[model samples]
Target: MSGYVRPGNSQPALLFPFIAGVVVVLSVLPLVRLAMTGLSALAAGGAISVLADRALWAAAYYTLVTALWGTLISVAIGAFFAFVLTLTDIPGKGPLGFLFVLPMMIPPQVTALAWVQMSGPSSPLLKALGMAPPLGSPQPLYSAGGIALLYGVQHAPLVYLALRAGLMSVPRDGVEAALLSGASPFRTFRDIVLPLALPGMIAGAAIAFVSCIGNFGIPAILGIPASIYTLSTLIFTKFSAFTDRTFGEVALLSGIIALISVVGLAVQERALGRRDYRIAGQAGARATFSIGGWKFIFLPLLAVLLFFMLVAPFLALLAGSLVPAYGVPLTFQTLSFHAFEEVLLRQTITRTAFANSLFLATVTALGLLALSVLAGYVLSRRRDAAASLVASLIEIPYALPGIVVAVAFILVFAAPLPVFNVTLYGTIWIILIAYFASFFAVSLKPVVSAYRQLDPALEEAARLAGAGFFTRLKDILVPLIAPAAGASVILVFLIACNELTVSALLWSTGTQTLGVVIYNLDDSGSSDVASALSVLVVMMVVIMMLLLEGMAKHLPAGVVPWRS
Candidate 1:
C-alpha cells in the first residue's frame, strides 16, 4: 500500500493550478484592456457614453418581462408534468416521459423557424382545415408571446428532468404516512412532495430563467418580425446595424443584464445552500395515486401538448425546408430537395460556417474538459478557501449572458491594453475564448459533483505509498471519473455547436460560424438555406448525443456514482 503512494507533492498538483492560473489570466486580460482603454478615453474627454440609451432600456424591459413570464409558466407546467408522472397512474406515462424529453434535443432556432412555417396561412394543415387566412395577417408566431411560448416549450423539458429526478428520489414512506394520517392526495403532495422537491425545482427554474433571459435566436427570428425587441437583439442592432463600431452604452447595458443574472444565481445558491434532499438507503415500497376520471382527461391533454410542442414544429421545419417558397401552398410539386442541394453546393458560407463551428466546438470542449478536471481535482483535494472562492467564481460566467460576454470581449479586445497590444477582433481565438467562458460552468458541474463522491483518503493513501500525483490521477481518479468527465465534455461540445446568440453578435467576415451564417441568411431573406443549415446543425447534435450515449454505456461501473 505504501508503494502505491504518489511522490512529488509540489510538481504534480501544481499542473492544474498552473493551467487554471493561465486560463484565468487569458480570460481577464481582455477585460483589463477594456477598462484601461475606456478610462483613457474618458480622461481625454472623448469617451463614448457608457450608459444605455432609451431603446436599450426598452429592450431590456421587454426581455425581463418575457423571461419572467416564461419562467413562471414553465415552472408551473413542468411541476404539473412532474406530479402527473410521479404520483398519478396516467396511461402512456413512459412514452409521455420520453416525449417530454424530446424538446431538449431540438434547437430553439429550428423550432422558431418551424413555428413560423406552421403559423403561415398557406400551411397545408391550415388549408386542409379551411382556416387559411390572407397572405398577411396577425399571428402568434410573430410576437413576444410567440417568443415566450417557444422558450417555455423548449425549456419545459429541462424543468421536467430536474423535478422528475427530485420527485423520484423523494421518500415514499413520508407520503404514505401522510396519506395514512388522513391527508388528501393534494395535501400530501403539497406538504410532503413539494417541500422535498423544492430545491431541484428551484434549480430547474433558475436555469430556465437564466437561459430564457439570454436566448437570442427565438426572439430574433420570431420577435423581430412583429417589431418586438429584446436585450440580445438590441445589442446586435447596436453593434451591427446601428454602427460598425461598438458602443459603450450598449456594452454598459449588456453588463448590467449580465450582472443581474449573476446576482440572481448567487442569491439562489445562498438561499438553497446544503438543503438538497438526498436518500441514503433504498426507497422501499413505492406508492401510486389513482387519478380516477382525471387520468382520462390528462392523458389526452398531454398528448395534445406534445403534438403541438414537439411534433408540429419539427414537421413544419421539414415541410418548409422542402418547400420552394414560404407562403406557397405545400404540394408535392412545391416540395423538393432543392434547398438541401443549395445548402450543400451554392452556399459556401454555410459549409464554411459548419466547419468553423465544428472546429471551435471541438477545441472548446477539449479545453474545458482538461481545465475542469484539474480545477475539480484541486477543489476536491485542497479544500482551501481560495479553492472554494475559485469554485464560486466559476459559476459567474454561467449566469452572464452570452451577448453580454461578447460585448465585453469587444470592448476589451478591439483596442490595445497593458501587455496585450494586439486586437483579437474577427479572430477564431476570440470566439473560442468566449465559448470557453460561457460553458465552463457546465463542464465544471458534473466533474465537481463526481469529485465530491470520491474519497480523498484514496489519494492520500496512494501518495503515502510513493506514487506521484499524475500517476495516482491517471491510474485511479481518471479511470474512476472518466465517464462523468466525458459526459460533461460532450454536453459542453453540443451546447457550443448549437450556440447562436453570442456567435451572432461576435462573428465577423472571416470568422463566420454555423449559427451566424444561418442567421445572416435568414436575415437576408434566404430562409430555405437557413432552414437547411438548421437541419444540419440538428443532425450534428443528434449524432453527438447518440455517440455520447454509446460511450456512456461503455464506461466502468463505478465511474458515475450519481447514476448508481
Candidate 2:
C-alpha cells in the first residue's frame, strides 16, 4: 500500500515490461503452445485414434485409481499427524515433523528403490535376515496398490503442511469454551476442530491427488516391469516410441493430465465454497489437549511410524549400497563398498549426473533469485491488476506438473530459434531453461514476502536522499531480504537436485541428472550402484535441509517449510 510508483516513473516503465516479458517467455508462451497443439490435434480428429486406444484408456484408469487411493492414504496419514502434532502436547514435535517430511524431500525413485530393497525375495536386507520370500515370487510392489502406497508415503507431507497451516488458526477460545461446557474431547474435536480443518484437508487431498497423477518415478520403477502404466508413464512411453504423430499424440495426453489436474483443483474449490472459516479471537496455535497418560502410547506409536517411514528404508538402502551385488546378502563377511566405489570412481555417467544436477541447481537457484529480487520490487511496489496477473502467470508453471512443462518446452525449443538458429532440444541448456521456468515461482515467493513486510519509509527516505533505484535495492533492499533470499536459494536447490520429472524428459546423453541416472541404473539392473548413488543424493538433500533448519530462526516464519 505504501510503495506506490508515481506517474512518469522510469523504474516501473523499465521493470514492469521486462518482468512481463520474462513471464511470457517462461510461463505463458509454453503453456499456450501446448494448448494450441492439443486443440489442433483434436480438431484434426487425432483424438479419436489417441483416445480410443485401449492402452490409453487403461493408463487413464490406472492414473485415476492410483491417484484416488493415494490421495486417501495421504490424507489419512497426513491428517493424523497434523492433528496430533498441532493440537496435542507431543514431545519432540520439531524433530518428528522433520523426520516425517524427509520422504517427501527424497526422490521418489530412491524411495521405491529403498522400499524394494527392504522387502521381497530379492531384498538384500531381508535375505540377510533369512526372511526372504521364495525365489520366483513376483514382487508385490509391481502392482496398483504398491504404487499407491508409495505415492501416499511420498506426498503425505503436502497434506500435513496444508492442514497444519489451517489447524494453526483454530481459535483456542472455542476449544476452551467447549471443554468448560463439559463437551468430551471427541465431541469437541468433531464439532469445533473438524469444521475448521476440512477445507485444508480437502485442499491437501487435491494437491496430493495432482501430485500422484504427475509422479513418474514410483510407477516407472514399480509398474513398468509389471506392464502397469499411469498417464505420465504412458506419455513417456509414447515419446520413447516416437513417430510422425508423436507430437500430436503426446500433446493430447499432456492435455488429459492438465485437464485432470484442473478438475482436481476445481473440486477442492467447490468443496470449500460458501464457507466462512474466519476466526474472531486471538489466532495462534497452541496445545489444546493434554494427553497426560496417553504420552507413553503416543510416543512409541510415533517412533514406530518414523522408524518405518524414514529409518528402516534408509538403513535398507545403506545395506543395499554396501552389498557387493544386488541380491547378495549383506553380512559382515560379504559387506563391501564396491557399489560406492563403482558409482563414485568407476562410473562416468554417475559422475556426470552428480555434476550436472549440482550445476543446474546452483545456477537455477542463483539465477532465479536475481530475477526475483527485481520482480519482487515491481510486485510489492504495485498493487494493480497487472501485478496480480503477472503473479498468477508465474504460478502456472509451478502449479502444473513438471512433465507438462517439460513437454511444453520440448514443443517450443525442439526447432532451432528464429534468430539464434540454435536448438535447445537434446542439450543441457534446454534442461536449464526448463528449470528456470519451473522454479521461478519458488524463487520469487520468499523475496515477495520479504518485500511486503518491509517499511516503505526506509526506501522513501533513501530515495528522497537522491539514491537511485538499483542503489537503494543493493544497499537497502537486498540486505533486508538477505535471509529470505538465502532460504529461497536453498529451497530451489533442494528441489532441483532431486528433480526427476522435468529432467527425465529434458535430459540428453551427456546431461543426465541425479534423478535420471538413478532411475536408469535401477532400470538397467545395477541396483547396488543405483542404491549407492541414491544414498549420496539422500545425504545431499539432508545436508541442505539441515542448513535451512539451522537458519530457520533468522529467516521469515513460513520460509522454512516442515517447521512449526
Candidate 3:
C-alpha cells in the first residue's frame, strides 16, 4: 500500500499535506471566511435587515418556481431520449444522442440569446423567415416561463446522462423471462424497467433542479430583462451596487443559495439511501425491444426534438450575428461581416476577454490536472478517515453554486494579505483562484475513476525494485492514466471557458472572461457584437468537443460524453 500510495505512508507523506493545503487554501478558507462574515453580520442584525427586503424573498420564490418547472421539463424530455435510445430500437441512436446533448455544451447565456433571436417580435431570424410577430409585442422569452423553458432545454442533457446509466443496467434476462411468462411489452416495462429506473430518474431530477437553481447566466440574460431575479441573480445585483453593507447582503444571499443546493443534495441522498442497485451478473446486453411499426413515430419525434434543441437555435444565433442590428431582417444582401470584424479585430475588450478566458481556462485545467493526478493516486490507495475528510472538503466548493463560491472567494481575498500587504481583489488572479475552487471536483473525478480501474501490483513491483516515487510515476502510472488525465483537463477547460456565474461577480474592467463580455455586450444593446461573440463561442465549444471525440478512441469508455 505504501509502495503504490502517493508520496508513501510515512509521517512525511508530502502528498497528503500538499492536497490538504490545496483544499484549505482553495476550498476551506474561502467558505469559512464567508460563513464567519455572515455569522458576524447575523449577530449584528444584518440578516434581519437583508431579509426584510421584499426582493430577496421574491427572488427566492422565483428561484424555487423556475427550478421546479425546469426539472420537470428536463425529466420529461431527457428521460424520453434516455429510455428510447438506451432501451428501444431508436434509429440513428448515435447521432440522435449527440445532437440531443449539444445544447448542454453551449453556454446557458448563449442558449438564452439564441432562443431570444428565434422567438419574439424583435427576432431577426423570425423576420427573415417572415414569421416575426407584430409590432409592440413583447419579447416572449423575457418572462419567468421563458427562463424556465430555456433552463429545461439547457439542463436536459444532465438528466439524460444520469438516467442513461441506470437504463444501461436493466437486466435482459428478466425482460426475456417476463415475455416468456406471457407479459405484454407495456406490462414488462411497467413491472421491471420502471421500478428499477425510478432511483435514477429521481436523482436526475435532483441534479437538474440544483443546476437550475445555481444557474446565473440564463436568468441574468433572460430574467433581469423582465425585472425578475433569482437568488443567484440577486446576489449579483447586490454585489454590482457594492457598499459597506454589500458584503453582508451578498453573503446572506449566498447562504440562501447554499441552503437550496444542500436541500437538493439531501433529497437525492434520501432517494438513493441504502438501496443495492446492482443488476444480476451477466445482465449487460442491448435493450430487448421490438416495436416494428412504432419506429416511424419514435424516430420522427426524436428528429424534431433534435432539430429544435440543436439546429434551430444555432441557426438563429448565426442569423443574429449576420444582421446589422437586433430586429433587422436577415437577408443575403442584408448580411455582412461587420459584427464579426468589429469583435474579432476592433474591440480591445473583446481581444482582452478572449486572451483572459483562454489563459484562465488553460491554467485552471492544467493546474488542477497536476494536483488531481497526485491526489487521485493517493486517495485511491488510501481510504482512511483523513482521506475521506479531505475528499469531502474538496467536494464542498464544487457542490455549492458558482455564485456562492465567488462570494466566498470575495470574502477570503477581499482584504490585503497579512505580511505581503498585497490584495488580490479586483485582479485576474482572483478569478483564476475562484475557477480552481469552483472546478476542482470536475478535474478530480475523472482521474480518480481512472485510478480505481488500475491495478496496484505493478507499482508495488516498482517499489520492490527500489524505483523512486517519481520514477514509478514517470515510467508506470503516468503512461497508463494519461488518457484519463487528458479527459479531466478537457472537462475542466470546457466548464471554465463557459463559466459566467463566478466571473460575473469577481470580474473587474480588464479581467473580463468570455461569459462576462457576452453578457455585457448584450446588456449594453450591442446585440450584433454579442451575437457574433456567441457564434464564435459556439464554434469553439463544438471544436473542443470534436477534439475530445477524436481522442476518445485512445481513452477508456465514458470519458468523452458524446462518444458511444
Candidate 4:
C-alpha cells in the first residue's frame, strides 16, 4: 500500500536513484562482502581453527561481562542526570549538561589516557600530590572493572538524551491530576511516570550496550595491558600477527561482534515489544516538585559528580603533558615544553596525522552533506517500503562496530581495481570511503528533522509555477533547512576528525590518522607525547562544541545535543 501511495511532493521520483546509490556503496556491498568472507571461512574450515583457540572463547566471555556491567552503570548515571536536569530546577543546568556530555565528544582513547593519568602508581599527578601508591603496585584500572567504568562514563550521555525525550513527553495534566489526588512524589513516579519512561530507558541501555561492544579504543588501551581481551581488541591483535589465515580469522571475529550487537538490539526490542508509549494530551510545563531543603544537598551531589567526570581527569592529563617524562613530577623547575614541542614541531608523523585527519574530516563532512541533504529530503517526503529499506541500509554501517566496517572495506578493496587497475588497498582513499559509509547517519539526522518541520505548500507552489526540482530545492527546501544542515556538518566533522578504529585497520605508512597516531604514541611508551597530542585534540573538540552551542537557538530542537 505504501509503495503505491503518491508521495508528499512533486519530486518523488528523485528519491529512488539517490537512495539506491547510497545503499549500494555504503550498506549492500560492504555487508555482503563481510558475510561472504565469514561463511566461506566456515565452509573451508578456516573458522574451525579459530574455534579451537581458547583465547577466542575467553575474549567472548570478557566482552559480554564488561559490556553488561558498563550498560548498568550508564543507565544509573544517565537516568539520574536526565531526571534532575529535565524535571527539576537544577542551577547551572546549561553548564552541567555541557560538561556531562564532553566525555562522549572526547576520543575514547583520550578518556582512557586521562583516567590512566589520574590514577596509578606511575602517575605524575599522584606523585606530585604525595599520594602515590606503594612501589610495584599494579594499576587498578587495567582490570575488567576499570575498563567497564570508562565505558559507562563515555556512553552515559546517550542514555541521558534518550530518557530526557520520554520524560519531556509526559502530560502535564496527568502529573497535576496525580498531585491533586494526594499521591506522594515517590508513589506518583512509580505508578505514572515510570511506565511511560521505561521504553526510553530500555532503548538507551541497548544503545549503550552496542556502543560498549563496538568500542575499540577503551579496551585496546586498558584491556591489552592486563591481557584482558574483548572481541574488538582480539581482532586488532589478529591483524598485528598477520598470517595466511588472517583474513578468515578477522572475519570470524567481526561476525561475533556483529552477533553480539544484534543481540543487544534484540533484547531491547523484546523488552518494548508490546508496550504503548503514548500520552493523551499536549505536554505543557513539566510539573515541578517543591523541595526547598533538598536543593542544598542535591546541588552539592551534582557538583561532585561533575568534578570527577570532567575536571579531575582533564587536570590529570594536563599535568601529564607538562612533565618532562612519564613518571616525573610536575614541579615548576621540572615542567618543560619538550613534549608539546616534539608533537607539534619535531615529529613529522604528528604533522602528517594532523593534516590527514583534517583533510579526511573536511572531505567526509562536506561530501556527506551534499549527499545527505538530497537523501534526507527524499526520506522525509516519501513514505514507502523502499524508503524504510533505504533507511535501515544506511543505519547498518553506522550501527555496527567500526572495526567491522573497516574489515569489510579491506575485503572489498583488497585487490586492484578491475578497470583502472588502481590500488586503494593501502591508500588514503580507502579510509575516506570507509568514513563516508560510517558517518552517513550522523549527517542525515538533523537534515531529515529539518525537512519534516517544513510545509509542502512552498514546494507545491513552486511546482505549480513550472519551477523544476533543482530550482524548488534551492529556493524552498535549502533555505528552510540550512541551520540544521550546518549542525549536521559540524557534528560529522568533529566525529570524523578524532575517529581511530576504522583508520587503525586501514591506515598505511604516511596515512595515519589522529586516532591511530595517539594510540601508537602511547603504545610505543611515549605517553608524554601522547598526552600532549591528546590535549590538543581535546581542545579542538571543545571549540567545535562551542561553535554548535552558539548556533543552538537558530537550529531545530535536538540538533544541538547540550541544548534543551
**Ten contiguous residues with the weakest lDDT in model 1:** 555-564
Report the Cα lDDT for residue 146, model 4.
95
In angstroms, the error of model 1 at 352 is 0.4
> What order do you get sorting by lDDT, best first?
2, 4, 3, 1
Counting only residues 3 or more apart in sequence or on different chains, how many pairs clash (N, Cα, C under 3 Å) in candidate 3?
A: 0
Residue pairs in steric clash, candidate 4? none
> Per-residue lDDT of 1-564 in model 1, one digit per residue for the tens?
333322544235456467567556545554554445545545644334543256666787788888877787788878778878876788877567756766766667777877776776756446534567776667767877788888888788778877776766677677777789999998887877778778878887887888788888889888887778888887777676555335545655565576667666676697679675665433733346878999878988888888888777666667667767666556766677888998888777877887888899899999988888887787776666777677666665666677877776777666655586767778887788888878888887777777888887788798679777678878988887887888887888888887887787678877898777777787787776777777777677667766665665655332322122
Q: What lDDT does each candidate get?
A: 0.73, 0.91, 0.88, 0.90
Clashing pairs in 2: none
Model 1 stretches with alpha carbons more than 4 Å out = 1-13, 26-52, 88-95, 122-131, 241-245, 266-295, 416-422, 455-465, 549-564
Stretches of candidate 2 off by over 4 Å are 1-10, 285-287
Better of 1 and 4 by TM-score: 4
- After superposition on all C-alphas, the RMSD of every candidate to the true structure, in Å, is 4.1, 2.1, 2.1, 2.6
RMSD value for candidate 1: 4.1
Which model, 1 or 2, shows the larger TM-score? Answer: 2
lDDT of 4 at 216: 92
Query: Which window of 10 residues has the lowest lDDT sum in candidate 2?
Result: 1-10
Better of 1 and 3 by TM-score: 3
Model 4 lowest lDDT segment of ten: 1-10
The numbered model that scores best in TM-score is 2
User: Model 4: how far is 447 from its true place, Å?
Assistant: 0.4
